[model samples]
Target: MKRFQVFAIIILTGAMLLVASCFWPKDNIVVGERIIRFIPKEEILDFKVKDNTQNVDSVIAMLESRAYGINEKAIRRNSILDESVFSESDYFVNPKSDGGGTALDNFFRYLQKSDSSLIRIGHFGDSQIEGDRITSLLRIMFQDKFGGSGVGYVPLDDVTSPVSYTRSSSPNWVRYTVFHNRSAKGLYCPGGTVFRYRFATPESTRDSIGSNGDTIKIKVPACSYSNATVFLKLFRGYSVAKLWYGKATEPAELKVYNSKTNELLAEVVLDSDDPFNVMKLPLKSNPVTLKFVFTGPSPEIYGLSFDPVVGVQFDNYGLRGHSGDGLLTISSDLLKAELIKLNDKLVILQFGGNVTPYVKNEASLNNIKNSYDRLYQHFRKAMPDASVLVIGVNDVARSVGGTYASYPMVSRIRDAQKEVALKNGCAFFDLYQLMGGENSVLAWNKKGWASRDGHYSDKGREIVVNELYLAIMGEYNKFLIHGTTAGK
Candidate 1:
């Protein structure tokens, strides 16, 4: 065909496609885990995605220069990074009504004189903060200043390898969670997980020898008679340590040993049939590594805590793909009991982002907001004295002809979050606005802070954590200056 004939054919095809776009369905199609959108004629020409990243390498490069220098004798820098990102989000949404708008007041007051008290902060969210991505840094930011040692809570089978320490369990242990099945039973741990172990007996190789000088081989039963061990290495000194487990249906023996020295730390016989129990280890010195050996019928190990009775600790209980409403799965009484026992002081909830795809319109958004409100109400009942901090969803990008922009419903979600938070007497942090409003995800992706315009990268988490630290410190400083009436 001639060049003019080819050009005419291409133009005709393009025109046909453009005209046919008008008939496409307006509603987004949901496929498995993705929302497929069909573009209409009106939005066919808009290429609005912008590069919004800022180069702050020089200003924040020195943030994560070193690791947390943990020492029980002396106070060191709280965290590796102490610099602020100077984000557009300047303050939290704590409204005043009749001079009673103190949202984070309880938490701030605790931080003011935290030297003698136990302050536990629970950082709960979806995969964004998984594997201790965001909570580890925040724990560092507060622990040294508040006088704490040890990592907070380590579940029996922490699907994500944590950042602060190493935890290895026996292969025979089975893990269960409420994320996939919201109506899951049993007393779930704060991490939304629970572990079960079939009782095992030690290999009787030494005892299998016969008196007639005959040698016999013994095969340890995989399910009922194999030695299973749980190993923990903190790499640093921790003044306190404890283990949490469920009812000991049968008599079991737990032997705690110092892996480095082979020294026997403690041996306990667990036969109590209580629904829950705490085994506090007797640590003579700040040991770095320990091993747990289980023999006989084992109880359900809920989680472990390597923390002090007095100081600050943040537990990372991130549930991937959770919409903040999954907390209802765990028995409310059990949940409240766990929080009260932990002495939980603050609960920082980072949600909305995970559920945005499910919310397409006003009713869905409102449903999410109501869900969050219910979540906070449950939390209040669980930890009456604890303060809750609601972080609005960060910017999420949607493409329009290759132009990426914030989801249209993001602002509405943020507004709903703020409104509900203030109404429920919880502190609200406008994280969506904090990242420069609309194109923030794109900007973060441009700076390599977030991967795929959503999940945060290392640099992305750092800047975000830095901003949060600055915000918390800002409020704490005000509390220091103005006392409890700072809001006035």
Candidate 2:
């Protein structure tokens, strides 16, 4: 009896182990354990037979049934060229410069000679960059390398997730979706503004230069929404002074005799209730910590440009579920305004993560291309001097044949993006290919880099950052070489 019991126990233990192995949850999937196995799409060959005419129909039907909606033929060949070619004035007009080489490099080359304190970067996308997923990492990296401060153009009030900038309270705000052309006017506390928020209160800060004197010189950034009013307030025993403004406003030139002996304060304000509202503030004061304020009605504001900087940095204008088309239709004027500020600036267009799952046919693929083309056209019109860089869709996962497969539509989108980028004098980055071609998401999941909670895990984001950082760095290096050698 004891020997029989021991045998049964051993068998039971073995069965339990098998069950546990079979029921384990996938690393990055939100599905339950039993449905989380890695069943390759190729292994699920469950097609059927029929008559001759039915046979062709069957094949097409089967392919479509298996998520083969991608128009493999629609993809264009890569045409981006080396930065050296961009130096020729004729090269700029050449139809071919529109594609190929790293898009990031093309944009940077435009800013190499600019006197701005920081180069401005805009990362527009769907849900990926929300809460600073990809944009935050890019900001830290870029700002560290370049010189800038203040989280660039964040919405006045954020409801979807907590922004890294100033926190908000009260639910009485209204929300608007640039994608659907919908506004939460009737709803309670929409929590979003249709326009950029501009502050009116004067902001004070210590002069980077020793403020032993009364006058400080500052420059106003070349920005959109030039129609703005800045209010300078004197504080901390600081007296009021005559204010001057300019694209190159300098605080060092302020005329004050022994004014530095007494404490003085200055308040600057750029007032606007429209989107794309950006203005620069230039002030001169004694070397003390300064306070800067922007006062406004109902919390509508825009971009603030400070003196002593040559370039603008990261501006987080990412909207959830935004298809990049909303701006074209809903806020064309505002977008145009923003583009004006960015004239001769760098525009990084990041998208494709949201459209991958919805693509179903060639028509859909073409439609997406057209949509992007429109978006690109508007951007071009707004910032004719700036360069545009379109990043192909990143690696993402989809369920196929009862298991997740790296959707092939990603490639189709990349191809489409490349074609569009090249056609419009823009640059393209094959983000999907950069992340390891097909099914890289699976590796990310298996390696525990991604979380099973749907969105990318923190680890997964880091991995993405690593790859993107390399790509951007390489592109920047190319710009340096070409700018020094070719004069592009």
Query: Compared with the true structure, what per-residue lDDT tens digits does model 2 show for residues 26-99?
Result: 46345564544543323333332211122123322332243211132431112233443222221121122434
Give the per-residue lDDT of model 1 (tens digit) for 74-163: 322232222231222354655443345366677776765567777889999988888778988888778756778777887766667777
> Which candidate wins on TM-score?
1
Error of 2 at 189 (Å): 20
RMSD of each: 11.1, 17.7
**Candidate 2 off by > 4 Å:** 1-106, 113-116, 180-276, 279-308, 330-333, 342-344, 451-455, 484-488
TM-score, prediction 1: 0.76
Could you say which candidate leads in lDDT? Answer: 1
